[model samples]
Target: MTSLFVDRRGVVLELESGAIVFRENGERIGTVPIAPLSRVFLRGDVKLPAALLGKLGEQGVGVVILSGRIGRPSLLLARPHNDAVRRVAQIRLSFDEPFCLQIGKTLIERKLTRQIEWFTELRENDMQVRYELSHALRALEEHWPRIGHASSAASLRGVEGSAAARYFSGLQAVVPNSLHFSGRNRRPPRDPFNALLSLTYTLLHSEIAIALYGAGFDPYVGFYHRLAFGRESLASDLLEPLRPLADQFALALIRKKVLEKDHFSTTEAGCLLGKAGRTRYYAAYGEHSETLRKGINQEIEWLTAQVNEIMATAEDDVRSEDDFEDFG
Candidate 1:
């Protein structure tokens, strides 16, 4: 399945027969059969009716809405999979403190390792990139041994956040000099690069959430991230390790000079992707791109398997799964 992005304001999207229709200024601009859409993304001021939403839900299509200039987003997932036993196992694992720490550490370790490798590959050609990324590498390396002794998720998060600061700082250096990027800032990304990062991460987050939900794991519950009302903390936890892929894609665009400075518009709140830029960016990432989507689904399946293994190894620590009450 592929994603459909609606970036123009005053655009009306609806379902007609078995196809999705796009109308602008009271005229039809495009039509796509429902089978082609895996997800629909509405950016800025696009309009859609409840009937179309129902059709999307019936087809199990995910919907994502991005708001304001910074593009903060929320997702509407389809109905959960019918797998009560798996969800029960997922909840049981979330309450396992030691296992949570282990998984969290492993996740951070993977992220740091990938970041180091990602930069190492670029350093041979660009000494300046290597020079800058080396500092961040040292920051990550210094704490590598400590992950084995991480006592709590909160403490592990501290290490992860510190490493991220260094990683992003060095990452910002790798982008084209013409594109502005300064550290990490969100809630209103301060520059074009930050805007790209935030938007990409948002998209990835929604993707992960849907993957987890479809895989029969509770998206709201997680190993590293704590639970909160209406938050998909598990997806957020998995997102930590996967963030580099999003960063890689964003930097690639700038380095390849596919999207120029003119591709973004600066505003008081932050930067926004111009229509031309959005089109170019989506083409590289949009639906039929199974490389990323397949990777994410595999990761989710691996995570679920990891939890099952953890449960077996520590089976004595928790109550038996069979003894748990059935929701039915």
Candidate 2:
């Protein structure tokens, strides 16, 4: 029902009569009922009993461990849906060129549309940045028509990239000059805004992946994003339209000064959010997470219905072919 975030170091977690008790320095710090938890996010040096892991899994509570300075996440997922047929349908659809193209167009169209709306809203409110926002808005609008006309996945991606470039350019105009945010950059995320973007996107991706697994969809098989090793392509596909949401959230953090340049430390590796900053970030995210999850759940439900329809139609087609053969 809710997510629990444990970001402190040296906190030991144990299961006590169906609740999770957090201990630090041999003293009980807190206790949380497991019944209401949908996921747990653990960062840094937190320790948990193995028995708690089993209980969490049994109760369908996903555990996300954010490790290292950059906070790379690893998931201990709950049991996935038992219906393998949905995954089979997903895999089959991935190979369907027309279906893939249509889905790709749909995803990009929705994303660009949201970007256009956001910039348009900002253009009205932020007079100082109107010129730049107008320029980016025009580019996004021009690309909008191209999505409907895209005949292949490669071309669709090209349009999406160009649109994204324009969107970020517009976004750059809104960010404070001190943040030094330009267009989107990642892997190291050279700027503070990009770092926030990367962190939020990572969290969003993990949430969608968990939803996909629960719905019996293979997170690695995708319609818009091609399959790649170690990549959750399906999750990436779902994430496309929702990126504007994450982008907006990140921008809010910077604009409101909840996250600032001082909250980050840069090394050769990349810019990393400091511990205090992360604690604040997690708290802020927890407040916004309910809205994010509602959007994710809506997407998941829509996708589930679409996959079920595809599977039914395929089954019907197979039955028709068998009947024809028997008649002959």
Candidate 3:
């Protein structure tokens, strides 16, 4: 299935001839067959009418609108996953302290392991940077136990934050100096590199949300991320392991010179890629995203099985405990 991305400004989408057509100044511009599309990304100033939206909804195609060019997306999904029992189990298990913390530890450790592997495999020629990355690799391995032992979500998040600072610091050593990226920043990322990171992570968030929805899970509810207004916390939870993928693309774009400083513009809002740069970025990002798609689906499928298994095991342990108490 195809994923449609409409990044052009001032384009209106409408339904015509069983296809989604783009219009500009009341003139036909382009069209795509709606039948093959599984997802749509509307970025920056594009309009989508109700009829077109309705058709997408009917076809079970997810829509993600990138409003204001950053942060989380406005995702349009079909009705909720059909598994009420699993949904209830997920909600209950989220509140299960032992279970949630255990799962959180696994997620954080997986991410840190990926970070270590990345630095180890980096083909940097700078001896100094390589030495620092080697040190960071050891530091990330040390943090794994700290994450596993975290007693609360707040504590777990704190560990994750420290790991990010450590990870990006090592990353800063490899990227071009012109980007001036020191560490991770979001909610109006101050520099071009951080802005690119934010954009890519948001895109990852949208994809994971759609995948979770397709896998019969509620994207809004999560085990690790605290419930918040309008936040798809479960998607954030899943995105932890794959953040390095976004980092990989951002570094490739800068280090490989696919994008340069001239391709970006800064405004009062923040740094952002220009139209042409964004087009190139979308093409590059699309390919990278395709490679990650297989992993995303596999991870979600595995998480679904893990959730069911853990809940069942927890229930069995409780029953055994009650039996022992009754016998005593």
- Say which candidate scores most in lDDT: 2
State the lDDT of candidate 2 residue by residue for 1-328, as single tens digits.
7889999878999999999999999999899999998889999889888899999989988888988877888888898999998888899889999988888888788888878888999999999999999998988899978888888999888888888888888999999998888788888888788888999999999998888898899998998898999899989998998999998888888878888899988788887788888888998898899888887887788788877888888889998988884435
Per model, how many backbone clashes are there? 1, 0, 0
* Model 1: per-residue Cα lDDT over 1-328, one tens digit each: 8888888879998889988899999999999888878788888778888888888878888888878665667888876788787889889878889878888988889888878888777776688677787776787688787777778888888888878888878887787767667789887777889878887888888888987887788889988888999888998888887778788788777877877889898888677788898888887778324666776876787797897776666666565665788889
- Our model 3 lands, by Cα RMSD against the true structure, at 3.2
Model 3, residue 231: displacement in angstroms? 1.7
Candidate 2, poorest ten consecutive residues by summed lDDT: 319-328
Task: Write down the TM-score of every candidate.
Answer: 0.87, 0.96, 0.89
Runs in model 1 deviating more than 4 A are 287-289, 310-328
CA lDDT for candidate 1: 0.81
The C-alpha lDDT values of all candidates are 0.81, 0.88, 0.82
Question: lDDT of model 2 at residue 102?
Answer: 85
Best by TM-score: 2
Where does model 2 exceed 4 Å of error?
322-328
